[model samples]
Target: MMTTTSEIDSIKKYKTNELIDLLRKEDLELYTEDLEIIRKQKINGRDFLNKNKEEFRNIGFKLGPALRLKEFAEECKKRKKRFSSYKTKKEVVLTKFGIDNSIKNIPKFVPQTINISDDDDEFQYCIREIKRKMEIIGPARSSNEAVRCLYIETILVSAILIVKRIVREKIFLEPQREIVDEEATG
Candidate 1:
């Protein structure tokens, strides 16, 4: 992960020039020691490992966020499995919902149990429910089919409600009609 001035010869001229320009702009020399070029590391501000675990205890953050070392280690193990399973270059993604393979990088550590005290958590809870429902299910079942089934169930419920309302009206009207007939006969 650390790069020294000695590796300068092995690097291409254009790259060296680029680094040279970057360091020059920062008023630093290229031959400086202890220069680190960490590979495969993003310099984003969202460093879950560095974030204090207690911040989550006080704040309203959802999910584990992998704050502790133990949690992060477990997350790493899960990610290694995912990366191994989906090794092809096409499966790698940058964000959660940006691309088709966006979910490929989600480190599926034991899914965090969400505490739903309010109504906001209901949507995520329902999605997790679907996950559990289709968990034992095979890849043969399509998402379109799931949506179709839900729509059909909605229609069936509406029909049942309509039929029940009609039957109730008939029952209430039949009693009134019988009383009128009895009075007319009397």
Candidate 2:
């Protein structure tokens, strides 16, 4: 069965003794006997998050699933750290303003979509800029100009994806649409 977005979200919010269920959701080839072993172990979310591949293998998971589980654990840990840091920064800002306790209805952070022009000019410009900087710093691994350009473009695109994902996670605050509209009109 295909997992819906809500189902995926619920999966991300894993609870104690739900590691096996998570494995199942990932569509890993797990045996019924493996499920029974995992249930008996009763691993909690925190413990699961802390486990490495070797540790997971020791806990009745096969090598491939163990590796995938370790990756999932790392991703989960990274998300928790990012969220915790965001909360800490928000609290610090609120405390600094002396309105931490007084404010009960703080607005949620919303991500805004930025419209890039439907042309390669901007992307090519970034690639050229990065290539220029790379030349100044040191020679690229490949002496072939085309190869270097391709490498630089790949890095630039990957960086954009990383930033977009971070923003999508609501790690940074943006003005609400209504507030932005009001400011533009006023």
**Which candidate comes out best when scored by lDDT?**
2
| Residue pairs in collision within model 2 | none
- Residue 166 displacement (Å), model 1: 0.5
State the lDDT of candidate 2 residue by residue for 1-186, as single tens digits. Answer: 444444445555666457677777766576777667657787765666678999989978788777877887677666655554555666788888776855675666697666654454555666676777677755667676655755666566645655666477534334334423443531
lDDT per residue (tens digit) for residues 1-186 in model 1:
222233232222324334334333432232322122211232112232233545433343333331332254234445545555654455444433355565655566795453434343434444455565455553335675555554444445444444455457532112222323443531
Lowest lDDT 10-mer window, candidate 1?
34-43
TM-score of every candidate relative to the true structure: 0.15, 0.37
- List ranges where model 1 is wrong by over 4 Å: 1-143, 169-186
Clash pairs of candidate 1?
none
The global C-alpha lDDT for each of the candidates, from Candidate 1 onward, is 0.39, 0.64
In model 2, the runs with Cα more than 4 Å from the true position are: 1-17, 26-34, 87-186
Residue 119 error, candidate 1, Å: 30
